[model samples]
Target: RKQLLAREMGLEPPATVELQESDKEIDPLQVSVLSVSSFIAQMRTVVGDGEATESARAQAARQLVRLAEAGVPGADPEQWWATQTVAEERPLNNKPRLSPSRIEALLKCPLNAMLKDTADNNSDKYHLVRGNLAHAYMEALGRGADEELARRETVEAFEKIQTSPTWKRAQERDEFEQLLVRTNQWIQETRGVLELVDVEVRVDVESEPGVRITGYMDRLERAVGEGGEEGGLRVIDLKTGSSKPSDEETSAHPQLMAYQLVLAHGELQQEGGLTKVVSSSQGEERDGATLVYPGTDTKKIGTADQARKGDEELAEFAALLPPLLDELAGPRVTARISPECDRCPLKPICPVQAEGKVTTDVNA
Candidate 1:
């Protein structure tokens, strides 16, 4: 009918088209599907075909060259090189120096970790500011500041921090005052046991030759034995947050585990020239790590067994670092949408969040 209409309109009739089903089963190998590179190659063939007009051929050639130079979308050259096989081992362009926070970030969401590092988002979040202030105050107090002096210094530090443009908001100022009061109370309660051997002590370990894991112990205390000799050590981390970490949380805590590993391997003593202290009792060892919530009467202490397990877990994570780093360095990474996304500053720009995978926690 279309051919007859075209003839009546003084135009050439359309060519007859026939539809046919193949006798042979469908073969994926025979299908015509082009990847970016394959499409470029096919275009190059078109460019070289002598039957095509010079202008058409030139256009095809130009497109092929432009695509080749641009390369594939979302393809990382470094990642490709890292994954390729080589005759001799070469040091990676990017070494995987890790910390507990980074490990946790990677576990929660690889995309989050990558974006957090690259994007300058949420640098001045209230939670971050609060946490930093608490850490600074604790560090100063642990360094042997007298009660009167520490309190004054903490206030001064808080004032100094508030001077920053990011923290100048009235609401932040109100929260800061409340946090300061809680911090001061915590200091008074823990003053009796605040004899810290080291404050903000750095622990650096080459878990594997090139895989370096490093973190800082918030406070370290020596346990004196019956003979008045130094016994085991207690690693303590101060928590300003309301939520008290559970026993399970403390047991699997990577930061505390990293500290434990440094102590277990005698690296802490070697690095600081500290004495190797053991428990005074017949069998019990006071050597362990704990998260102390100063304002509250809550403490999450890791058992000796849990400490050992933490060391093992950290070692396993360190061993897996090389490949994990490579994967994260790649352009493609997994973005998990969970309750955590609610607090993630990157949510606005996150593809997964845009897809409506994010949901608010009713309990929260």
Candidate 2:
């Protein structure tokens, strides 16, 4: 139908090109500076190194005291930098989402939302560090490289958080280390079982006419082939945390799903021309994994059943685009005590909470 429409419109679709550039480049300097600075500032407060820079910093310092009293060296400094660098790359603007975390944050607290969206700074408490560690490790593993080395690197990064000099207070450092070791070990075990292929792809897409979304996927693999033409794409979303979310949660989660949708669009450019979804989890230990969907790529139509049933969850997510954009651009009715706020670590700093309660809670 798309081809026919193109013909009717006298347009010839351009040939597809495989992407060559890698994921966002990380400057070693930038990574080191940001991580080291953040870590130092955090440590200084924890040790009462200086007067609290701010209320949040003071809160963190107090929290660190508790961690120390509980016996937690602090995370390895090196690990902290590595993970923090990764965070800077896949930030909100560049990240695609059917249901953005930022949107969820905004729905919960507008002020908290502004801090992240407009200010471009997020409270460290909710930073998805564990998820990122798992993701980084998974990406390395998928490339069929040194798994042990990847594991070690990830562990080291994690340890950086466990053993900072700034954490001079009393706590059970051994206990925290033990937990981290167990967590990483389990992640290593899970990575050991998964199959990965060096499926490199270049995706050239237009988010809308004249606005293109072009990028390359370093690795791709087939988790399941629904037989012949209907097989699906299951792109992995390596996570450091437990993967326990349901299919609904996976489908509803935006980032991972957006990645899947991106992959699907790339697949559609080929002959078999199918919509692919890249699905992955944080890891086995934290829970399991959270799924996310961006959108489909194929212009081809499928059987009504396939369209309605197999892909219904994804379709529904995509349908949310309009409202999401509106909310982002317009004045949002303020609300409070959102159930979503529970998972958010920034709730304390959130101004909406300072105001009052409002809105529908999807989780509720």
Q: Each prediction's TM-score against the native?
A: 0.55, 0.42
How far is 278's C-alpha from truth in model 1 (Å)? 19
Task: Count residue pairs with overlapping backbones in model 1.
Answer: 0
Worst-scoring 10-residue span by lDDT in model 2:
301-310
lDDT of 2 by residue, 148-168 (tens): 687677766765554336565
lDDT of candidate 2? 0.41
Question: Compared with the true structure, what per-residue lDDT tens digits does model 1 show for residues 1-364?
Answer: 4465345334456797774566346676544454765555455555667996676566665665565567744233232322344433443335556664566677677778777655554545545666777777777666656756665666556665554466466665655555555655654554444445777767666555555556666777665555667656667776666666677877777666655555654344434444332212132223667676544533432222234444456567456566556645554466787778877767765757753332312121
Q: Give the TM-score of candidate 1.
A: 0.55
lDDT (CA) for every model shown? 0.57, 0.41
Of the candidates shown, which would achieve the greatest TM-score relative to the real structure?
1
Candidate 2 vs. true structure, TM-score? 0.42
User: Any runs in candidate 1 off by more than 4 Å, and if so which?
Assistant: 1-93, 117-123, 160-195, 224-229, 269-286, 295-334, 348-364
How far does residue 218 in candidate 2 sit from its true spot (Å)?
Answer: 9.3
